[model samples]
Target: MTHKIAILGASGYTGAELVRLIATHPSMEIVALAANSKAGMAYEDVFPHLRHLALPDLVKIEEIDFDNVDLVFCGLPHATSQSVIKALPKSVKVVDLSADFRLRDPEEYVKWYGGQHDALECQAEAVYGLTEFYRDDIKNARLVAGTGCNAATGQYALRPLIEAGVIDLDQIILDLKCAVSGAGRSLKENLLHAELSEGYHPYAIGGTHRHLGEFDQEFSAIAGRPVKVQFTPHLVPANRGILATVYVQGDAQAIYDTLQKTYADETFIQVLPFGKVPSTRHVRGSNFCHIGVSGDRIEGRAIVTAALDNLTKGSSGQALQNANLMLGEEENAGLMLAPCFP
Candidate 1:
């Protein structure tokens, strides 16, 4: 049974990624592609690499016939998804790739996003879309809120340790390097080749990054206490991938064992050999997450690193993984392509 689909914000990086992955899906078909700003343009014109696939031309969201769409992948910008999703048909299961519904608390939503959530009812029922941790909830959800790419990378490294009590929650620190694509397809002075190619610097330092809200919400929930991780994110010159190096006070071997056991049955998460480390290059353009653990030179300390394609495992690919569960399809369907390694 092939499921009909529609993609909103289809001209963006994550939107194009959803199209790329779904192009080869066995049981899903793209029926509509909506990008209000680029309405009436050929999808190929916007993303030349995808010219090979015969995709629907970009159209305005209001032009789409939702009755024909079984699922809608909402990749609209932050705060935009709420109003748009609120008006969609109740029968259309939604996997929102925006920041609007990710925070469960309405106040937290306002605190980080700078506005009150307009779609409170939808936000109230939307399941968190961290596929591994929220699989059961996603399987039965009508709306699944996709996680922040940086937040996703950090969680894959720390969640197990926090849950197993293998780390000192108070001493947790996450330093992440993210590719520019995670910023979306927008043009900016800093992202230009003249400026970005040779240098990398941190933004959202001192726990100011919005994804910290996610870390606080998820980590605190798992530890049964308020777990605040000191998180800082840096923008690299690369076009894809995220690498999160987490510092924790714990038994190195025990932390490694916890991650290995937690992801033993997970199809997309790979826990590397202890004392080894992961690189963004290894998991680029794939739905896989590679995690590595090593003991710090200082006793009682450990370093856990996780790498994944921000546009894939961190966003669109993660969205599809949740969609598979929601639609009753095999969770790994359309998501098993191997990483693009050099």
Candidate 2:
């Protein structure tokens, strides 16, 4: 059964990525493309690389006919997706690529996002879209919230260890570097080419990054206690990908074994050979995540690094993967394309 899909914010990078990946999906078709600012323009006009595919012109979200759309990919901004998704037809399964429904608590939503969750009913029903760990939940969920790219990377390195009880709960530290594309296509004074190209610096230091809410929620749940890790995110010069280096107090071999065994049957997660670290270039533009582990100079400590495309596995591709499960289609059907190489 072919599923009809509508991308609610088609002019942005993640939305354009959804179009690019869905263009090859055997069971999905892009029936509607909505971008309020770019409404009425062909998708090709917004993303010239998509010029070859036959696609619909952008429309306003309010104008879409959900009766024909099986799935909706809401790639709007964090605060914007909540209301937009709440208005979508109930029968249409939604994979939101924003932060609207990621945190489970409404109070935490206001604390981190600075406003009350406008769609509390949907918030209660939305499933966190961390594909590997939440596969069963996502498979049956009608509303799935895609993770923050930085959150996804940090979790890849720490989740398995936390779940296995092989790492010290209080000592986890995540030092992550993300490409500019993760910031979205918005223009900002700090994101200017001149300001960003020549140097790299950390922002959201000292556990202030919004994604920490995700890390705290997920890790605390896994450990059956409050597990807060020291997390710092840095903006890098490149355009697409996130690399997280996680420091954990544990035996290196045990950490490696835990991750390898945990993801042994997963398709999109790759556990590299022990001591061999992964690079962002290896997983660029693909849904795959590569994890590598190595022993630290200090005994009882290990460093695990995870790499993935912020736009793909970190956002749109992950949205589609969850959509497939929600629709009962093959999980990796349209996501098997290999990563691009230099």
Candidate 3:
């Protein structure tokens, strides 16, 4: 029952994270590691923290032998994953960490991503990888698209309320702050230490952030109507985690009760005691998501906060969760490690 896993783009943060988690998975093993730019280098050379593990030397995606791989983690960049994944062996289960197959509609893909989906067939078959809501679908999907870190954060706060009909559909607003690591390992002018430290700024304001497509698609489906929220994402200097504050119009107590009841049986989602908010530090390096609710000054409104390590629950850990479902293993296996604390 051992599953052989390959990580394409292993030099990146999320890919490195996949290696870290899979290193402990009882049913999975890392058989191939691909990093086009870092090809032929030992994995430990690029990530010294992983020096203790026995891992494959980095190879280019085209050089991999998918015949022996049971699963592939596509951690490539946005437009890049589609083509790369389409080229992977059809029998290999894929958990794409990019935005390639996340949006259901091809038109929406072009609208948000600014190009035609290179793999329409794959897009059509890919299951949304929000493990809690799409557990059954993920279990049988050949391709699973991981949710956007920001999108996952907002949904954890609002999905239950929307599904239970306890909140106003038109009044949702998501204000999220994410760590720089969410930007990926690619070099960026703004992500440099000198520029990013001691500064933070909100980009993609006014419903323009690409993740809004996910929010609109999922929330609208839950409410059985078009549900668009005012979403703004800010880039912070920290290296990992996402903190989302959601504003919803609803009875404060009702909103709290709804979230608590909805997540009571879920292992990775934690609903904090009412009125007690969660912090990003509490969930860092773990797949767990912490949600807290409090009443706003207005009686009919409430604020819901959710926090999780963007690289863990937000990306790689989520990918692993879906892979477990695909492999028919325990949903939380290899993911029970507690969050790293300060």
Candidate 4:
């Protein structure tokens, strides 16, 4: 039986990505599309690149018949998802692509996002959608919370080292360069061409960024201690992709071998040869993560760089992977497209 699907917030970047991937899926059908702002338009009118597909017209969230939608992809903005998901029918499984459900603690949610979490019950039940590490949990979960794209990229580079105790937990640092699309298809003065193009700068420095909550929560859990890593994200002019450079005190070869072995059987993650590195261009527009390891001149230090399309592996693609598990579909169904490289 084909699984019927509904995409909430269908006018945004990640929302359109769901249409792009599901268009080619064999067992999934797009029965509805919802976008509050573009409620009366057709899908093609919102995203011309997706004009080829015969999809449903966009409508308000309330207009969607949840009884018929076997699964839902909530791509709405951050705080919006919590209230929206709370109102969803108990029978409709969901994969949420916002920060609403990623962090498990209500206090942490308040600390980072500010204000109390109105949907406290749902927050505790949502599974962290890291896919490989949380595979078993996701398969049985009712609501899977898609991770922060930056958090996903950084974890791909460092999770193995942290788990294997091969790196100094106290002295790790991550520097990420992300494209503008990760900011979403929103209207912001900073996103204007005159301001963003031909320029690059960093924001959320000094531990103020919210993804640090995920980093701290996940890493600290893995090490059974307070593991803190200095992280800074820089926004670049391109449209998609994230490049995360992590520095740690460990053997370069050990780091490479650990990552290579950890992801050896995983289809979407590729670990480059020792002393080699990857470019964001290598994985753009695809659900693949390329990680490379190199030794620094300082004997005890190593640099690990990981790159992937922020829209794909980081957000929408990640949501679909988790949704597949929730609905008992093939884990990699419709997600194996090759990376777009020039």
Whole-model Cα lDDT of every candidate shown, in order:
0.94, 0.93, 0.93, 0.93
Tens digit of per-residue lDDT, candidate 3, span 1-342: 899989998999998999999988998988899999999999999999999999989998888889999999999999999998888879999999999999999999999999988999999999999999999999999999999999999998999999999988988888999999998888899999999999899998777889999998999999899999998899999989999999889998999999999999999999999899999999999999999999999879999999999999999999999999999999998899899999
| Model 4 C-alpha lDDT versus the unseen true structure | 0.93
lDDT of 4 at 321: 90
Worst 10 residues of 3 by lDDT: 204-213
Report lDDT (Cα) of residue 23, candidate 3.
87
Which is better, 1 or 2, measured by lDDT? 1
lDDT, model 1: 0.94
* Residue 163 displacement (Å), model 1: 0.7
Off by over 4 Å in 2: none
> What's the C-alpha lDDT at position 281 in model 1?
95
Question: Which one is best on lDDT?
Answer: 1
For residue 17, what is the lDDT in candidate 1? Answer: 96
Worst 10 residues of 2 by lDDT: 204-213
TM-score of each: 0.99, 0.99, 0.99, 0.99
* TM-score quality measure for candidate 1: 0.99
For candidate 3, what is the TM-score?
0.99
Q: Please provide, for model 4 over 1-342, each residue's C-alpha lDDT reduced to its tens digit, 9 standing for 90 to 100.
A: 799999998999999888888877779999999998999898899899989898999999999889999999999988999999999998989999999998888999999999788888899899999998999999999899999999999999988999999999999999999999999888999999999999899999999999999999999999998999999999999999999999999998898899999999998999888888999999988889999999999998999999999999999899989888888899888898888768
- Model 4, TM vs. native: 0.99
